[model samples]
Target chain A: MSQTVTKKLMLFFPKCECEKPIIYHLVKDHNLIVNIYRAKVTPEEEGYLVLDVTGTEQDIQRAMDFVRTFNVTINTTGKGVTWDEHRCTHCGQCLPRCPTKALHFADQATRQVVFDEAECIECLACIRVCPFNACASAF
Target chain B: MKTYEQINDRIESGKAVVLTADEIMDYVDKKGVAAAAQEVDVVTTATFGPMCSSGCFLNFGHSKPKIRMSEAWVEDVLVYAGIAAVDVYLGATQLRHGDPANMYYPGEFRYGGGHVIEDLVAGKTLQLFALSYGTDEYPRREIRTYFTIHDLNQAIMVNPRNCYQNYNVAVNDSDRTIYTYLGILEPGRKNATYCSAGQLSPLLNDPYYETIGVGTRVWLAGAQGHVYAEGTQHAGDCERTGNGVPMEGAGTLALTADMKQMRPEFVRGVSLRGYGVSLALGVGVPIPILNEEVLQRTCVRDRDILAPVVDYSVDYPQKTGRVIRYANYEELRSGEIEIEGKKVAVGSLSSYCKALEIANRLADEIRRGEFLVSRPIAPLPRHAKMKPLVIREK
Candidate 1:
């Protein structure tokens, strides 16, 4: 019997000019191999995108790195972790410190930080440096 | 209404009040004046999963033993007590309703979810309080106890002689140390026969443990047992690897088709939530108070358990501009450490290490009479809330 393999990746974007298309782009670019899923985004709250990327690790990483070029905030799940946005000031203090550049400053009007889930290595360097105490990880 | 000052006076004067669950209900029904009160700490135990050596072998891994907490009160009280290293058990109903990210156990699909508070409260244990300490600055110190479901139930159902002696040893040992053994549930007992006596019989009945005879065994082999065995065996292989290894090796490996079928049972079914408490007492205090101090101290007397023994060349950053290293836990414990080539006063080590230190500090604080057992008599708001909730709510 054939088995279906799937991987769910959750991406949180503080701000995004283009919304639904981003999901479409990821799927189309990845040849629909990945099942792109979106997380619920709240207003005034930072925008987050959860991508359920179903494909090979390399393919997933390729798609993830592709998303990183946009320079937004992102995070992956299932490694036992949770992030607190309340402590975040969106001062862009952690953007430079991110080794993978998984975080980007949002549009000034939006006061959001883009989280590139694909680029996040879960090293938690951003969490370590965030003075506002907004980041947390679990194992 | 009594002021905070009056409440503090009453508490200090030993005239402080403690209300049971029933009394609290009466007070609420009568619309009585909400006064400062405290909760009496109750300890209970809970059983966990199939007996396996998964969690005990390694310092960290997915297959390790776990317990989860589902109820809000238990989570709040456990957190308020500054305790970590607890296993939160989420039942199936809870997972479906709560959509909790951490519901990673199988039985969670049926029963209501809850958490395992080791050394605090055991299985099905509940404590309703009107007042209790809820502050990080001054955390409450209470005599919390925990037990497992198997032990608690066995104590209630099984006669003392019928139960195994190992149960006592296990419970006593867990009570004395940071570690607790979560009992396993085994299905398909062979040759077990139940017999009941008269109503006035002092002993209820005994389950005669035996094996089936040849004729019965032949019939059983053809029965559902074969299918059950095959399914269980397949599940076991999937949960473990093809070779029956618990976790995948740390590397890139492709999952075969057979492995895919078992993914949900392997990945999603085993939800293990750990709870930790920060005792104001020093890090090592609980060891002694728990009566494992002498053993642990003796064990580590000649050797350093927390010594930095990782291969520095391999573990250290290859492209290092400024590297900060500590000699041992002592240096980190002292709070002064060189970070990135500068003398920086460190409040604590990494979060992992900080949890250990905080737990120790809290334990010590309790020992020093600096902290008292206080619960929230009235539902406190965020500002009045003691410690920030660490675990996120879904």
Candidate 2:
């Protein structure tokens, strides 16, 4: 078995399994270390949880496969970032807020702001500074 | 020495050579100021930044009964009333009535007076409403309807203050980030942002106001405009560096331009997070190189224009002795600088790229004889002093 690895993920539970205590099973049965950063759950509706899970590579893969048996969707990506072209004024307001150089002016002549998703640390600083609410994230 | 008339004649005949402040520096460095003065007829300077005092006057066509508007709103943002019966001045910083009042974590300012003005200039129809007390002659109490910039009798942007000569650099020392009109300032001096475009700025190059004054034509928001008066908060008297540029805020311009000719690219709406709404305006002024002294003044470079970084977390004008020391625009634009043993990143409120575009475009207009240069009807006063307010115990 490989060494323990940590991964941040988002788990979505459909309405059919909203009442099931999947987190309890992950902790007791699987013996996985989990830290829930955010959770939104309702008795009769879909639910979501953002968590950091730590376990052996094989154990983590098995745990995710087991989650699929409950009809729950798991995404290992931390968060999703999207830019609304219609709303963004290309004013470059969010350029400085980004700690990483993921966002910058495209070139000298156009001076339009562009975002490179690969370089983004997903700190959401751009979302806060954007005056037009152009930068949005899915958590 | 070239006279204003001679320069005007040259411009009219398409013979006057124009260069940007940066280009002028190269010309002057290659040949001395005297020779450059003989070769270059004009040097252009420009700045593009958020100017809060920007606004426009709109004359809504007379209603059935002209209402002396006591209260006015454009797209839910309040505008200045008490002007003429039908005229209203829409200020850029005015927030909508529905906007959140929170200062720290206030949400985005999606739309406001600035957007409304921009929409009007773009030939879009906007809702205009006004309430007033009914009178004998003008008995209309309230009016609400859509008004386009074309339908309005007149639309003119007469900003009380536009271009600032040299502004301070903003930095934060607190543990938490602070959102200010200067933009988002990171905590622990992680970043520093300055406003002016340094040597490319018009007023900074003409530090003493020798050539720029009332009636001087400038490239305002991609349109031709003229300086009307000395701007509000005009600080002619201030400490200066050896180069004669003010170490603090100094001269400003009260400008006026027709709204019909403005381009949207040059007019941008900005929201300073916690602060309020403002308009990013592009302005370019041409300096006629009449003598070698004027040419030398216009040749100042980014390395020589120094500005002090100030802590904006505290109350301003009262937070004395908070300056970290002066840094030139060249250092500030380097993206990171060591200050007090810490590496602090840098940002800018003024767009150097846009300023360069405006300067080049203005030079092109002059070279093609499409734009006319005007002499100032009256020179700006040089002895004016800015005084600080003191709170005295009663």
Candidate 3:
């Protein structure tokens, strides 16, 4: 049986390659479900597209190859955490629980908690202790 | 000196000066307490934290050939139906029936009464299952139905205890990790968890309950409520600092509000791993600056409030009440604090920013004459101490 995986990818396009329809090729050609979290790309100017593409392991690889034919830059953002801002209450309960303090208050005045994926050691402590289930781990 | 009536009159005329407990700290520093008392009409204080002794009473309209529920549950979580034929009380900490609580793993505690209450307030529909022994007037033995808060005749949030004047800073002195309601405690005091709004706490602003008592109107979960009674275990005679603030948990308020009107954001359901479920409540109380002495009390700062550090793995379980050290919010919120010449990381269970937001929101209402400040009909009991339970052999 084939396994399915959801991977976040960052695609950078030159102004000339912006008309290539990369999103259309991802869904129609490879039969992938892409959730575009952020899109700065336009038809006239160079920008980036950050999305979570879900499909079988092989299909995602084929989509990457198809995207590379356009000479666009690609970077895998890792199977890290997808923080749902709506679910987070900013209570700061996940701070001391994280061994590396990956989830700390952005500042004292606002007290908005921000997650630094670089500091997260895949310990899964945030997923274990979060009362609101705001943080999700792919692994 | 000003009277509560005078302050209210000024509020209605759009001439009242309102400030949050957080905002008053700077004002007092710049203009002094006497000046603040003369300028400010009310000081709003708030706390958003877990209070286990919280629950709501709901009255379901009588059904056709009603079952008169003797046992009932809302979305698998049990509700106490002993009150009346159609009334039930859903406790915040009540866990769902047959939940795998530590039997398989260290318990996930996904769904519970608290979650149900939040869903109810959010206008989500839920399944209600009930059973009863049929009576002459009520003939049905079972009922399975879908309902929401709109289906109820009345829904009231009645919390026996809501705000803690001060609280413990939980740490682990043992060599192994442990799970508690305060959150996970790492071994050897590697990390700590403290739950309180510190200076913004309602009772902390009024420490002695001078103006806060039965019949005092308050802001509860984004709606208006009242301090109906003295909360359980309200230790009014606890140890205090030179400024009269309690050094430990003291002065609590029994609050009540219409659960239907409460906003879902303020009435959140929280689950602590290895511990059961609980509700995080938002409550705010307005203190009228009737005199300089009252105004001075509300001018507290985070650096001035203190909490005792205790070992959750041993002392707390054994009720030894051993205090490792005392740390204030200033040191705790610094992200790291030193104890015995070693640095220990700290986290807060209470939302400090949310408390400030609630205080400011209530202050806006007062300034706009939307929320009125009221005087207490009577003062809270003085020198009320909590007693320990004992086992008796007959």
Name the top DockQ candidate.
3
Per-model TM values vs. the true structure: 0.21, 0.84, 0.86
Better of 2 and 3 by DockQ: 3
Residue B64 of model 2, lDDT score? 86
Backbone clashes per model, in order? 84, 0, 0
DockQ head-to-head 1 vs 3, winner: 3
User: Which stretches of candidate 2 lie above 4 Å from their native place?
Assistant: A1-93, A105-113, A131-139, B103-107, B315-317, B390-394
Worst 10 residues of 3 chain A by lDDT: A77-86
Which parts of model 1 are misplaced by more than 4 Å?
A: A1-8, A16-20, A54-62, A74-139, B1-394
By DockQ: ranked, best first? 3, 2, 1
Best by TM-score: 3
Better of 1 and 2 by TM-score: 2
Report the error of model 3 at residue A118, Å. 6.5
The global C-alpha lDDT for each of the candidates, from Candidate 1 onward, is 0.27, 0.83, 0.87
Q: Which one is best on lDDT?
A: 3
TM-score of chain B of each: 0.19, 0.96, 0.98
* B1-394: candidate 2 lDDT, tens digit per residue: 9999999899999999999986888878888877788988889999888888999998887888678888999899999888878889999988888898455365567677777777777788889889999898888999999978888888899999889888898888888988788878878888887888788899889999999999999999888999999998888887788888888778899999998888876777777777878887889999999898888899888888888778887735356756777888878766666788888877677778778888999999999988877889988778788766687998
lDDT of 1 at A119: 63
